[model samples]
Target: MFVIDCPTHGSRVLLSERRIRALRNTDTGVLLALECYCGHVEKISTGRRAPARHVPE
Candidate 1:
């Protein structure tokens, strides 16, 4: 269970799998398809990645 912000319902609690519409893996994080009790659906990504640095020879 996690907390997600829903536009229609303000901050909402994701009770269980019931709130998960879909999920997939991303290069940097997991893409989450979340649904609020108000039926609002949104996508969120988990994890963070720093920008790649380029080195000049």
Candidate 2:
């Protein structure tokens, strides 16, 4: 799961399952572009590298 902070809407949403479109590092932190099921797209910062996730087959 990841926290998405929407700049345009000035809101924060919790996304448990979603797709990450892109990832980029900037002076502030790590920027992640994500798409939600509700058709909302936004960019968010995690401050640091998100912990590695594992999935069971």
Candidate 3:
């Protein structure tokens, strides 16, 4: 439900449901990877971007 623009790769990385649950449980605020528009990936934080558009399946 979150989107982040990768500085290294100009792609949209979308957060998955599993990642969302994991994030909610954790407190360390780690960076997790999500699928990109081009099928690539990048890591973003809960602090970096807010959950916006729904991630495509």
Candidate 4:
């Protein structure tokens, strides 16, 4: 499962594996194609080379 900021849900949602549409390998990381409960599909990356997060200190 993975969490993404879903526009329909108006918050981050933990998507289940059943909603996953596809997966791909990239130089940066793993590409994940996931579907939100509202039927919105989004692709996100994960792994060591993925984009860095700018969290508030």
List the RMSD of every prediction in angstroms: 9.2, 8.8, 7.6, 2.4
lDDT of each: 0.69, 0.66, 0.52, 0.84
Expressed as tens digits, the lDDT of each residue in 1-57 for candidate 1 is 756766686555555677889888768777778787788877777656523434222
lDDT tens digits, residue span 1-57, model 2: 766665555666666654678888877678788886566786666665554434222
lDDT of 3 by residue, 1-57 (tens): 766675456554555554433333245455566655555555545543445445443
lDDT value for model 2: 0.66
What is model 2's C-alpha RMSD?
A: 8.8
Residue 45 of candidate 4: its Cα lDDT?
A: 81
What TM-score fits each model?
A: 0.64, 0.49, 0.35, 0.76
Query: For candidate 4, what is the TM-score?
Result: 0.76
User: TM-score of predicted model 2?
Assistant: 0.49
Q: What is the lDDT of residue 32 in candidate 2?
A: 82
Off by over 4 Å in 1: 48-57
The ten-residue window of minimal lDDT in model 4 covers 48-57
Give the CA lDDT, 0 to 100, for residue 27 in model 3: 57
